[model samples]
Target: MTTTVLQNIRPWGAESVDLSIEDGLVTGLAPHRPGSAVPGGTEVLDGGGLLALPGLINSHAHVDKSWWGKPWVSYGGEATTQGRIAHERTERSALGIPSTDSTELVMKEFLRHGTTATRTHVDVDLGVGLDGIASVRAAAERLGGALEVEIVAFPQDGVMRRPGVLELLDRAAQEGATSIGGLDPAGIDRDPVAQLDGLVQIAVDRGVELDIHLHDGNDLGIFQIELLIERTVQAELQGRVNVSHGFALGDVQGARQEELVAALGEAGISWTSVAPPGRGRLPWASMREHGVRLGLGTDGIRDLWSPYGDGDMLRIALGFARVHGLRHDAELAAAVQLTTTDSAPFVHRDQHELAPGSRADVVLLEAENVQDALLRTPRRELVLAGGRVVVEGGELTL
Candidate 1:
């Protein structure tokens, strides 16, 4: 067993400690000792008293379609979702959207920002079929396990509007996608019941998780959310269903909002948000009070749809904090947690932290505490993904 000891690092800004790793999992942690001796053949790295955080988790990403590492493509898509969808379909093929090289570049950007794991949505439509998924898998393999990516077979285009998409999603599930994704049932498909029912049936049949993107706002969006809650309970998919960008939750007010939040908790449905500015702030306090899980993400950085984001989860967390008006230290720290330990379930990890028995996915930064790190977004000094040094001194070593 190859062993590595990271000496003199502060986990979550706590006292300095030496963290030991063996075969990619944290084996032990001891109080930092300057001259501690190790067995022969053990690799040692000095941490320089940097604040250590568990590698950031990107709960929602579109890794397959990012335009990173390519020449700057001017954004020409309409601001609407459907417009963006059409624009991408019209232009993606010429740009090679799902090639392994481009996907690898996106993964490298994530690693450089200390993101060791992600639950990325790969477009699974008629145009690309399963090629996007294959490309993402190949990219991850090329990285040699430096990043853990859970796949979601996403119907980026409307599912019901286009035939064969349901079958594609089904095939993706059978071929080892951890989850199948859906788009706005009412807005995009115009058949909320049929769309939700179809996706839910696939989830029940394939035994895979379901993650639906809901961008429709107001009553239409709320109506579909209710349908999802009903079906999730009926299908016994509690804890296996997620709503990405369910903006309706933020558009409602008063008792109706309270009821929906409560129902979501009881049904075990979680939510993931990119925290886009100018949108309503999520009722995070109520969501927390009712046991609802929330995960943060950097959605589609430098994609054709929008020219924003750099795949940095810290900046995303800071945006979330600023959008939610978080002022207290604990609140800011919790925001940081949204991108790290609290996001483990988003990527299907039972535990993701700097403690023993967790994967040795650690990020060391020059910050005094978690809040400071979130606010300032410092460059990572060292990043160890699965016990392998992938980044050092703010640069990718892999």
Candidate 2:
């Protein structure tokens, strides 16, 4: 087994430690002090005064709709709601999603974020009309070694409204789609609750996870969301279920919102949020307090649906910290969790910290402490995946 030595690793501000790699696993980590013995064939990384933590994981993303990858959904900005939506409609109509630019750029930029794993959504062919799901799966395959990737066969448009959508969702799951996704409870169909229930049933039968997308925050959405949670619980698919873009919860008012929060808390459903700096709706604190697995995601990257995300989970993590007002320790955890803990299954090993026998998927930051690392910077001193150096100082070598 090829062994490498990382001599001066200040793991999450541990002061000092020596990391040993054996066959792509962190075999051992001993405290670093004077006269420390270096294992044979081990190349120690000079990472003193810097924090090293687990590689970030992007829990939810549209692989084919990211900027570095694809189009903005055109949901304009805080400046003008109607204008943003209009712009997005125009751009998305002109170029559409599941485009080549969206897929490739999203993948490339995700890697640039020190994300070794990602669970991304692929457009159901119903939306793009050319087996877009297959295309995304292919893209995920192409991005395999570069990033730990999984594709969810997502019914971007209403599954029932689109032709052959259910079959495609089923086929994708049967063939290896990690999760099933959908959008808008109220807008998709008259019985939005029933519609999503059907989709979740399909996922349950196929033996995959659920990731539902929601847009409506009004009574229709709240009712459907509650029903969605109830249906999952009834079917015994609670913790395994995920809800993306629960923006309605963040935007709703009064006692109704509180009631929804309590119910969602009971359901054990996780959530993924895309809170930009000025968006009126942000749900991190409530979700976290509710014991929900709050995950951060790049909903879109300069694409047709939304034009944001720079592909750096570091930035995403920092944004999460600032927007959510996380404490130092909480921020540290968020720094890793935004890309790690929140995103599951992609995590072949459920670890957000570097420890013995962990996969050698780690990044060295040019920081003096974990607090500094949490502060967010583009400086990635070194990135090691599977015990191989793929990037150093933000430069990709292999």
Screening candidate 1 with a backbone cut-off below 3 angstroms (N, C-alpha, C), the clashing residue pairs are none
Full-model lDDT for every candidate: 0.94, 0.68
- Who wins the TM-score comparison? 1
Query: lDDT tens string, model 2, 20-90?
Result: 88887787888877567675666766665457877777876777754453222345544333344345434
Task: State the lDDT of candidate 1 residue by residue for 294-378, as single tens digits.
Answer: 9998889788788898989999999999999999999999999999999999998899999888999999999999988988999
RMSD of each: 0.8, 3.6
Q: Estimate each model's TM-score.
A: 0.99, 0.85
- Name the lDDT value of residue 375 in candidate 1: 86
